[model samples]
Target chain A: MNTDPTRLSAAELAHAIASKELSSVEVVQAHLDRIAAVDADVHAFLHVDGAGALDAARAVDERRASGEDLHVLAGVPIAVKDVMATKGLPTTCGSKILEGWIPPYDATLVSRLKAAGMPILGKTNMDEFAMGSSTEHSAYGPTHNPWDLTRIPGGSGGGSSAVVAAYEAPLAIGTDTGGSIRQPASVTGTVGVKPTYGGVSRYGLVALASSLDQAGPCTRTVLDAALLHSVIGGHDPMDSTSINAPVPSVVEAARRADVKGLKVGVIKELGGEGYQAGVRARFDESVTLLQEAGAEVVEVSCPSFDYALAAYYLILPSEASSNLAKFDAMRYGLRVLPEGIEDPSAEQVMAATRDAGFGDEVKRRIILGTYALSSGYYDAYYGQAQKVRRLIANDFSTAFEQVDVLVSPTAPTTAFKLGDKLDDPMSMYLQDVATIPANLAGVPGMSLPSGLADEDGLPTGIQILAPATQDERLYNVGAALEKMLVDRWGGPLLAKAPQLTAKGA
Target chain B: MPPEHARGRFVVREAPRLAPMSALSRDDVAHLAGLARIDLSDAELDRMVGELGVILESVAKVQEVAADEIEPMSHPLPLTNVTRPDEVRPSLGAEAALAAAPEKEQQRFSVPRILDED
Candidate 1:
């Protein structure tokens, strides 16, 4: 009890609350206080539900006092990405159009988290409509990286990863369309999982790319992510696309933390040349660590991965254009009238509202997507991208036959400076090169801190991908590598991050 | 546009650069905006044409390998048509459904006039 409970992992906090070493209220308050102290500098949360969180925490304490059996991670507090719908809390998806919209019903994952007795802390910031890599495109403002305020935390789930990295929250939910969760986790030195595409229910998740968006865990420790994953990853009748099978035993796999005799494949196409030198160095070191841990490491190539990023851009924007069509002014969210028009038509209003609401990136994507899905271009753009998608999935199917899991650098480099690649869309898209293939193929991927890069002293992440439904393998390998890295570094990677001081605190 | 300019700032070593596709034009962008129901200013259209041109040129690499024999994959799951029993269930009330509407009239979303008729 003497230690700051905010710094403890979710598992540790749950143990403390269950054993009466601390009340849920105390633990929740500690996190709330931490959020208040550091959030000014971090800007991770779009909204902090202090009162609602306290009430939920108190309910957990009451349940414990009444001797009612609770879920394993009960009383643990979590931050949710704004992309997921929250019943009472404002869910903006980082766009001005839905700035004040409060969803009337909870996302299935949010409902699951609440049922597990995890207090909903608040909605964290993200890129507009979960679109950008650096969270700079968020209509509200950019979320500053805690490691270096000038740098990005990575996005569109930057706030979720940043909250965990800044120790303001033990767990957060992030949706990964194209490495939104994993890349942010990579840059911020946290753990993120993009569950097998259909592994987690997508009900209530604001769609960016319907076929690609899968909400998953963002946490500081591999075990915590596993626990949160267990809570949120189950079949839901509400989501037709949800996997009907039982959630993979990722928690047990994380607990096992053994990869001895496992076949680990290094994707030949994912690395070399384009990767930053320091990132490559760290990845190579992690491979050696895995080899020493008794994993049989071999090189496996996915030749079709060459077209992955290209296919992804086409597929994502095409789906996003259709999915985002729901935001027409006739429905919920923003609506604006064209100026100087005494009688603004509905079409004009919709156009004016969209023009005012969407950022440059969102507009760019929508336009590109519309063009891709348009009559003449449909066969050439969207159709071709889908075919490439099949090839990418085929490559994964082939790779899994030779190896149990595949590993690569999570991203091409560590977090670049905010605004560095903002002007260049292609440069920004390249940041997600390694992580995109998994989403394209619907495979589960986890990114954990490898170590800090020598050049910038920024954290580099090693990504582990398991074939669809083999998600447990990722947890097993990730936990094993995490344990080894922690032992070598003498602590977790986030321990080395420069502490954030509240401005004028 | 040259191949390098079309690829923009980032270079993908593995992706074989294909012939640059038609450069996206302002009129094309405006037409796309109209289709998507997004109003864009002249500057936005100008900027977007250039940006989309680069993106389109780069993404055209997908056509290099996406042969006709390969089938398209729209969804990862094999789930075909997931239909539940048609029995009606409780859903959001009218007030709740329209809670976030920018303009509402008596629990229904009010919108700008569409038809010319009264």
Candidate 2:
């Protein structure tokens, strides 16, 4: 057995367990120890299900002993972003309102993970209700970047990103609504994919923006992400928006890792201007590498992309305002009675609870959404944003006509300092400018670590987008680029992350 | 460890302004807050008026591209009228459903009274 079982990727760990060379219990224990050693500083997990994970690992070992057929990813452990519900496990979604709320039912994806015999380590932290670019919006506190502890792990899935980067878990789940998944992956030097809208089930996911939210794998390798994607992606009768078609051949594509004859379109509008010098340099080098690898690279202009950020904020807030209306202090979650008032009305309690529970970013968006959806302003704001959404989708359809996949720098820059954009909401919103177009168009997008930016010595990620339902193309290009970058650096980008030792030990 | 302890560890960091503030009035913000059912103090409202004003001005660009011919799409997929047969299945039982309720009585969610006795 390897000295450190936690260091292996999910794919490798699965192979080891399948081969009988290593036990699932050992791997799970190693990860728990790693979490104990470092999570105090990283704070990736809101709750670590050490006992549950080990029990599941033992169950998998028994299944193997019985010679029963097991899933490919059986015995591998994963960290779930807290946004997804796990039956009997606390699913907080990084908000004080839902703190300590142990969901009675599992999200379809979580059930799938359990059925596949994947032990869930715990629920990871996230931006409060998945509302911010940096996890600082989390009511629990921010998840620091593993590369540089002073910096943020890109959010709202910062916890997932941090765990993968820090080697606490080999795989994780992250939902992207306006770049929650990809942006975090970019900044953390990991891999994250936002599967095609409706490509993955959203039944158990806590909704932020119904139209834009799609969960996918967060992993250290493109192949591992593809493997996890195969495990989780499928048609579900429970989710009306779920695609009835079969999950794309993402695993096969990742294994191929060949971009020969692929038309990779560099999005004309997604780069330059506000882009950091180091991010652009890394992105440019990756593009050149793709061209040299026999892929046909072209520049495709998606004009409506310019309005993507504007349309996304308006649409997201509008939907969020309506979706979040469920937390009314009635059925579930935190209920705060109005202070200094006897027999306060339910409405008064709800107002007070929300006022105390939700953080600034969540409040800001809710207000923006309420105003957008207001009766008088609906046509000019929410309605117009929906129209712009259509145009963005149209632009994607046209761009796909000339290209197999679109490429861009995942986020405008690498991970900024923890407090860099806290006061400025607009600057924080700009971080998702490159990744938002994919969610807007309902396309699949992947962010793979390109290289470390020269200026800040932080990781930069290259985003690959495929037309809706052709999600496999993202894996093909992503894997191809990941392999080339690994070869160039002589190791994975995450191998360069500064080790997190026990603080004050 | 109380949950609020986790919050208190990080100092509140404010963002630098990136967009020009527009004309969203304080009253407008208060009305939106009321509609959203989020009770905001006067200081928060004052800050929101400026923050939301800038956000609205930035997102107002959506109007520039809103053409009359372009139909608004509420979802990405074109399929509509998705329905399931109306058959009851086992679901969260009363105990499970009421378990997370902040206040419960008689297997029902208990809330503050709304009506005045006539």
Candidate 3:
């Protein structure tokens, strides 16, 4: 058995616990210790529930001792993005507005994680309301890339990806609305998936863009993602939009890991021009490797994808504006009285609270959404964006007809320095160009490390997109590509990252 | 090739070739912020005017191919009117529900004055 339980994959740790080789308490404690040692520099977690995790781990050990049948992932520890509601845990959604607001009920996915007996480590950091491409928007703080401490891990789900890459947790849950999950995974050299839009229940996921938001897995390996996915996915009575179908056989597909005779499409629109040269090189090499493995590779065009970013900006702001309207200093969350007012009216108080609570980016989107949905501009902006959404979806349908799956570089570049694009919102928005189309179309997407970029020696990721409801295909191809890449590098890409010890040690 | 619906259609609003980049003004942003119930500081309003202009200019590209014949898609799924059998079930107790509220009184959410004193 591995001496350091922190280094073991969630699958291996689960196996060891099930076989009574390593107790669940030891596994959970090793992760808690890892979080203690390295999380200072990584800033991957907003809170670490050490006591709660130990209690859960102890219960699992007792259950195993009593010869109780347990779920496959039972006893394995997991981290969750702060965006999802956790019954008794703070779910701030990286915003000051909801700071210290503990949910009354667990999100459907959180309930599933608890039911599977996975010990919850705590809430990870994120962009405020999952709005930005960089986690710098987080009111708490940005999560730094484990590879290069000065660089971004990726936004919205940066903390989840960082935790997995830094070995703070073997598995984490991340929600993707316009590439939150996959983009972070790309920059961090970890695996992240955005399942089909309705594939996972969104009952207690604080709504960002109701149409685009979907929670999926963040993990060190493809199989671990599949394992976590099956546990959290499936229909829920609480989420009316959740797909009423069994989760695809992702575990079986992951183990199959054979891409022979598979038709792979390299998206014509997603590469060249804006893409970093090193990113393109890694993607091309990955495609060649796939061809060498007997998979047929072809270039397919989804021209309508050219407008996907534009449509997303409009649609997301429109929905987010409405979704965020609930934080009006009324029912819950932070409340502030208007300055210089003896008796502030409800409207005045709401405005004051919002101004004090929301960060610049959140306010920007809310204002944009408000304008988009306003009287005369509604048809010109929101309605037109909706039409474009259909066009993008149609493009996916057309492309999927020619190929089994579409592929691209997950993000346009490797991790940039923390403050590089902070001032320029448009430049930051361009980072999600390749990953957003999958979310807009509601198809599943997976991002796995392709290779390190030659120029910067930073990790680059290859993204795989499958048709809606055919999520298993992503795992199948992702696992196959990951295996090939690992064999070439002689280990996982994360092995190349700079090692971190306890801060000030 | 354009999709069937988008091809050869006379649209009510012809897609603008190049929407003016500086179309949004500081006053417009302030108005929008007011509508959203956010009291933006003058500094924030100034910065947002520039930032949001760029974003709006870029996102305006969505109007390019939004032909009249194309249908608007609100959601990825085709689900509509999803319902379950009506039955009383366990729910959050009043205390639990009001636990996180900023102000609560008499088992209900308390708020600032909504009407002027008569």
Docking class of 2: acceptable
DockQ winner between candidates 1 and 3: 3
Alpha carbon deviation, residue A170, candidate 2 (Å)? 0.3
Q: What DockQ do you compute for every candidate structure?
A: 0.49, 0.35, 0.62
* Model 3: per-residue Cα lDDT over A1-505, one tens digit each: 5689998898999899999999989999999988989999999999899999999999999999999999999999999999999988999999999998999999999999999999999999999999987799999989999999999999889999999999999999999999999999999999999999999999999999999999999999999999999999999989999999999999999999999999999998998899889889999999999899989999998878888899999999999999999999888899999889999899999999999999989999999899889887888889988888888898899889999999999999999999999999999999999988888889999999998999999999999999999999999999999999999999989889889877542
Which candidate number has the best TM-score? Answer: 3
Q: Write the per-residue lDDT of candidate 3 for residues B1-118, one digit (tens) a residue.
A: 3332433222233456443658778888888888999999899999999999889888987776745788999999897888777989999999998898899999999999999877
Task: Go through the candidates in order and give each one's C-alpha lDDT.
Answer: 0.91, 0.90, 0.92
Better of 2 and 3 by lDDT: 3
Cα lDDT, model 3, residue A1: 54
In model 3, chain B matches the true chain B with a TM-score of 0.80
- Candidate 2 lDDT over A1-505, as tens digits, reads 3468888989999999999888899889989999998999999999999999999999999999899999999999999999999999999999999988999999999999999999999989999999988899999989989999899999999999999999999999999999999999999999999999999999999999999999999999999999999989999988999999899999999999899898999998888899999999999999999999999999998878888899999999999999999999999999998889987877889899999888999999999999888887788888988988888888889889999999999999989999999999999999999999888879999999989988889999999999999999999989998889899999888878888886432
TM-score of each candidate structure, all chains considered together: 0.96, 0.96, 0.97
What clash pairs does model 2 have? A422-B14, A422-B15, A423-B14, A423-B15, A424-B15, A424-B16
